[model samples]
Target: MTGKRAFVTGVSKGLGAHLASCLAKDGWQVTGVGRRPRESAEVSAAVDYLQADLSSAEVIGGLVAKMDAVPDLVVHNAVTYPDRAAGRPELDTIETTMRVNALAPYELTLDLLAAKPDDQFCSVVVINSESVYHADADSAVYAASKAALRVLTGGLAAACRSTNAAVSTLMLGPLGDANKVEEIRRIAEKRGATPAEITRLFLRRSNPDLVIDDFIDFDACYLSLRYLAELGAVANGMLCRLDGGSAGTLV
Candidate 1:
């Protein structure tokens, strides 16, 4: 990233913010897309911000021009996870999840690749998750959406073989960020699971003897993002598991 440009999605907060900062610190001219790109203080320091919602392709058309020169690194990191439904939900959560998690990233990357065909070491990384192989009480939409992304990564990588662009994917496990934990809990609770159920499985279950008072940390999220970014050259068109503990892996 010495003299390259990086574009990351979902940079309003969480892993996206950390990823943007890390890339800028590594000398990448970074641009971040988010719902509220204006007031992201962390993003402002390290990269330019665009208020683009992945949910709407109409908004993305205007934003694409800003990066027409095309970036060296593109991360389709923005995602939509579904809230748990106590009763069967009539709403098409899978449609929304699939569009945001899978289609938008695929479309965005294709546009970027078309403009930057001659660029060297261009990488498109999708942030996936362990949930792909594991089942949750109410995560059908989320799992299916990420599975779509996983398939896209493989197909895109094959397509990129003849070009300079490379495609890689990373799957995430649980992180240590409080906001992420809260968000997960909210989704879980919406599915009718109690807070105690969350604590027993996501928190103390992993540690066995630890305190339930623990919260997710930001550095772990940053480490996962940064690790994938750094591995772009060596890991072109490959899906690497970020979870060492088998969460993101099948075996």
Candidate 2:
């Protein structure tokens, strides 16, 4: 991937930041977009950081203006993780999620593809979630938004078939995070059980064949990016599940 250029969204933190760092280390010129500045100086130095609120349609033009050229790879990883306890989610919440998780990426993909030269091979990677397949009561809206994105990804792949662009969807599972673990612990305490026991029960209920060991970590993002980068035109429309086989029949 040396000398290749990549545009990554949500690089201020989490998996997006990690992916950007990895790509820069591999000699890819990376441009990161996020609403806030990167917290880590080390990560900030690895890529050209651009602050833009992806939830709004107006941010698209500003984002494009910052890019030097159409990138070889585009990773859509930005998202809005709404609190499930917010009670019967408001319409605005749903709209914001849809705009940020689905529409923004779709628009950006189209814009980038349109700007690319005919001979350049561009790869678009959408970071999807397991919620699309395993929906729960609390995450109804979130799941729906991701499902829409999954559909959009399929359509984008088909549209790019006759061009030099390729689209890949990475359906991700649980990633390690202290706050998430704490949240699970709190829920487990309320249910009078250990975190491990609660987690096991939840996994079993979600899918009987799924094991707790199937959850992915930060490294999975890196692996997925590498796979998408190496993928040729023949594998343009691939929807890969990086959930350690836990998706089971859903895939």
Candidate 3:
């Protein structure tokens, strides 16, 4: 093991699960936090699990206080977007969304920073999303929360300039679900076109020269996060976008 500690939130599924597993394989001591236990046995074997609802500051504070080791890397990956089919969200919806998507990271990072030794190194990575740039009717609340997170992360970077703490944000594109590949295959059969042909047309709509999947792949995302984690204090205040395509790997 590298003997480095990594605390990752939202490890129940998707990119969170993949990241936890990847880091564990790379010899980092990983602790995964989620609202519930991980569903995948493989991921469960990769890291210690901590279950806590991120919407509650009290719960997050308690969680942080109970940590036995200072994490070298802290990944704020948990997020929530309320259903907004009925148009503008109610006041409660906004509160809940902000609590989970924005406030949770704020409270968690501050708590971790405060608890760490003055000279100890820590890297804070907030897994922001592209939705923040393209807030449609269905995503206004989520985007607002992410925007708030971006600003707060920048503030944290400044606050840590004289300290050992580092903060960075990874704004990401839509992550491709594995199921989308199969769905595209089915669509290809119906259209009497190869999957590659269909995917090419799909790419053209976004970028004519792009032929790869539109969603950011899990492996690439992991590489980018790993880069920031290893870069440590040098990466402070960095805001990077991983589009899962031509953006390429940071490694």
Candidate 4:
């Protein structure tokens, strides 16, 4: 083992799982936090897993307090969206989304940074979304939350400069399974039109460089994260957008 350590949130699946596993393979001792236990035995074996609901600041604080030492790397990858099936965003939904997507990362980062050893190189990576740039009807609340997170990360970056730490954001486009084709199909049917027509409409509102098929993979996301983590303080205050060539596609 490299004796380097990492703490990653949202490790139950997807990019979180991949990051934890890949980091472990690279000899980092990775502690992964999520709401539920990892279902994959192989992944579970590779990571020291902790279960905690991130929406509660108290719970997040407690989790951090129990750590033996602040990790060298902290990745804020957990995210939640307002239930699009419930129609327009509700007050409660908006609050909950903000708590999970924005507030949790802020709280966790502050807590971790507060405990870091003096002059140690620490890297914080917030997994963000392209939705921060453009949002469809179903994504407005989520986009707002990510926008808040972006600002929070910027603030953290500034605060960390005195401590030899860095904060960066990886704003990503649609992941493999998150392509909104099914959502578009539903909207198309509701509007008495074809799915292709709805897709065209979505395209009009999206970035001109949008590539519908250029969905990102979990491995690629992990690679980008690894790069940032290795850069240490050199990547401070950076917002790296990984849009799979689709810069402003609606999330």
Candidate achieving the largest TM-score: 2
Off by over 4 Å in 2: 39-44, 182-202, 205-209, 212-214
User: What would the per-residue lDDT of candidate 4 be over residues 59-85, giving only the tens digit for each residue?
Assistant: 877988778788899999988887778
Backbone clashes, candidate 4 = 0
Candidate 2: tens digits of C-alpha lDDT, residues 1-251: 69999999988887888888889988999999887756643354879888778988889756776688999999999999677767887888889999999999999998899889999999888999888877788888888999999999999999998899899888887776556677779998998988887766666776665656434677877987789778877658888877756677645
Worst 10 residues of 2 by lDDT: 37-46
Superposition error at 165 for model 4 (Å)? 0.6
TM-score-better candidate, 1 vs 4? 4
RMSD of each: 5.4, 2.8, 3.6, 4.7
Model 1 regions lying over 4 Å from their true place: 40-44, 85-87, 180-234, 248-250
27: Cα error in model 3, Å: 0.8
lDDT of each: 0.72, 0.83, 0.81, 0.82
TM-score of each: 0.79, 0.88, 0.86, 0.84
Q: Whole-model lDDT, candidate 3?
A: 0.81
Off by over 4 Å in 3: 39-42, 84-88, 200-213, 244-251
Name every residue pair that clashes in candidate 1: 84-190, 84-191, 176-216, 176-217, 177-216, 177-217
**In model 4, which residue pairs have backbone atoms overlapping below 3 Å?**
none
Q: Write the per-residue lDDT of candidate 3 for residues 52-126, one digit (tens) a residue.
A: 788887898798776898898999998887885667788988998999999989888988998999979999999
Positional deviation of residue 106's Cα in model 1 after best superposition, in angstroms: 0.8
What is the Cα-based lDDT of residue 242 in candidate 3?
A: 79
Q: On a 0 to 1 TM-score scale, where does candidate 3 land against the true structure?
A: 0.86
